[model samples]
Target: MVFSCLLFGASALAAPAPWYLWRSKLDGQVFCAQTPPGVGWQRVGGPYRDARCENTGVPGK
Candidate 1:
């Protein structure tokens, strides 16, 4: 039972969060992150699969 629980936990941690480009409303500067940076920032780009914000394709097989 403990091994099964550990497997499930590891699987959950393996999934990566989608990356997005957020544009700062105050300066129009774009930055990448898994979540919104803060107030005055809006998501302008995609839920990319890669860290460089280049993969916009659908995730999973």
Candidate 2:
């Protein structure tokens, strides 16, 4: 269990998780996230190759 927690934390802190264009499942709003934004979030496009995914949109990223 401890190992799993540590692994998860390491990934969370790792540089440059995949950039995702996330859309709000509830409001159709778009945003960006390193991982899928938990529940209520959906992937907008394929994995963004750069930080351009962080461009203008709803501020869920």
Candidate 3:
């Protein structure tokens, strides 16, 4: 639909989020990173939704 394209375009133009909230499956430790989660990591919430999620991008740390 036209609306879908518009929405996708809008999102594509937006600046990259500073961090992405992620949670560790091993210990349930929540943190933030600059990219998608690696193994053993899951997204805790949306990208750039909350500024407080920003943290070191290192995984499993």
Best by TM-score: 1
RMSD of candidate 2 to the truth, in angstroms, is 8.0
lDDT of each: 0.82, 0.70, 0.69
Q: What is the lDDT of candidate 3?
A: 0.69
The number of clashing residue pairs in model 3 is 0
Candidates 1 and 3 compared: the better one by TM-score is: 1
- Per-residue CA lDDT of model 3 for 1-61, tens digit only, reads 9999999999887765556788999999987666767899998764454457644442222
- Candidate 2 lDDT over 1-61, as tens digits, reads 9999999998886555556788898999987666767799888774655566744433334
Return the TM-score for each candidate structure: 0.71, 0.52, 0.48
What are the per-residue Cα lDDT tens digits for candidate 1 across 1-61?
9999999998986656788989999999887788788889999988888777888843451
Candidate 3 to truth, TM: 0.48
Kindly report which residue pairs in candidate 3 clash with one another.
none
Deviation of model 2 at 38, angstroms = 1.6
Question: Which pairs of residues collide in candidate 2?
Answer: none
lDDT of 1: 0.82
Least lDDT summed over 10 consecutive residues: which range in candidate 3?
52-61
